[model samples]
Target: MESTSPMRLSFEIRQMSPQQKLPSPDVGGMSRSARVMALLGLQYTRPFHRDALFLFFFALGPAVWLSMTVLFALQPSPRHALWSPVFLSVALWQPLCEELLFRGLIQGHLLESMPKQKTWLGLSISNLLTSCLFSLAHLANHSVSWSLLVFLPSLCFGFMRDRFGSVYPSILLHVFYNGGYFLLIGSATR
Candidate 1:
């Protein structure tokens, strides 16, 4: 004998268990656009803190260069005050932009789909690619020497980003590296 009532059928169906809970996706595994937005948000929220490292890098860079210049005054080269403006604008500005693009945005997105080991490998590959692009971006400078210098340092920046888990250190390191290079060049030229 079977019950044919509509209410009885509804009751039977209700007896089934609810579905199991699935694991939540990691928040860090956001899309590139989302990560960019997040980075921008971070910058906006803590503009001072974010910019502090850069400012420190900027100030310290010149000082370090001056010291090295004084110490290595024996090296003869073309002295040019014009390079000061170029160093601040090009070297500092470019590295900051590149860090935001590569480490903050692109790396954040790629890390989403990757396992731990794969994430490291992906980061390495992405860093290399990004660094190459960065180096190539200097094509207008039109010097193989400049390109070669940029390539290795850009890789070092990527490596720093990977190790520190934040682009801030790398940004600082980059500014230092560039600043040091300019200071050395400027001192040598003098």
Candidate 2:
């Protein structure tokens, strides 16, 4: 019988062809920031069809907004004016910034460190934590009740990020949600 030294075994493994080597979870020695970027889905996934995505969300957006409109006894703000700077900012800018931070950075970091398979009610652990934080962030400007109300939509936004593996879908949904809410139910001061 022959005994192999650790150094000799290591050398032998290095000599193997790439195909012969087992895959590694080390991400090819990527830097921490690079790995995080990859986790943030900097690269779009294969089979990302733009038209399909838009069509589905276009249908989904109206249904969701309409449901909320019917469920809540909300009335339009007396000062409501279309295409105002405040409305544009709330509908467009806020969604872009919030999605990039919550889904892109925070959730991306959590996904990288936590067990991806762990979930509650079909939502990933990373997503749940991120959604909770997203809702909490609203407390700075909104009432406790309103902050709590924000949680469900935050979850939906986070779900889109997880589902698409990109922040764009979340931003898109968020824009729709905000735009609809402001147009249909939100106060002018928002």
Best candidate, lDDT-wise? 2
lDDT of 2 by residue, 1-102 (tens): 323122112312123333322111245789987666667655454332343543465467666656666546676745645677877888899988898899
Collision count for each candidate, in order: 1, 0
C-alpha RMSD of candidate 2: 12.7
- Please list the C-alpha lDDT of all candidates, in the order they appear: 0.51, 0.66
Worst 10-residue stretch by lDDT in candidate 2? 4-13
Root-mean-square deviation of each candidate, in angstroms?
Answer: 17.6, 12.7
Residue 73 CA displacement from its true place in model 2, Å:
6.6
Candidate 2 residue spans exceeding 4 A from truth: 1-36, 46-80
lDDT of 1 by residue, 19-68 (tens): 21111123487998655555422233222233443345445555544554
Please report the TM-score between candidate 1 and the true structure.
0.51
Per-model TM-score, in order, reads 0.51, 0.68
Q: Supply the global lDDT for candidate 2.
A: 0.66
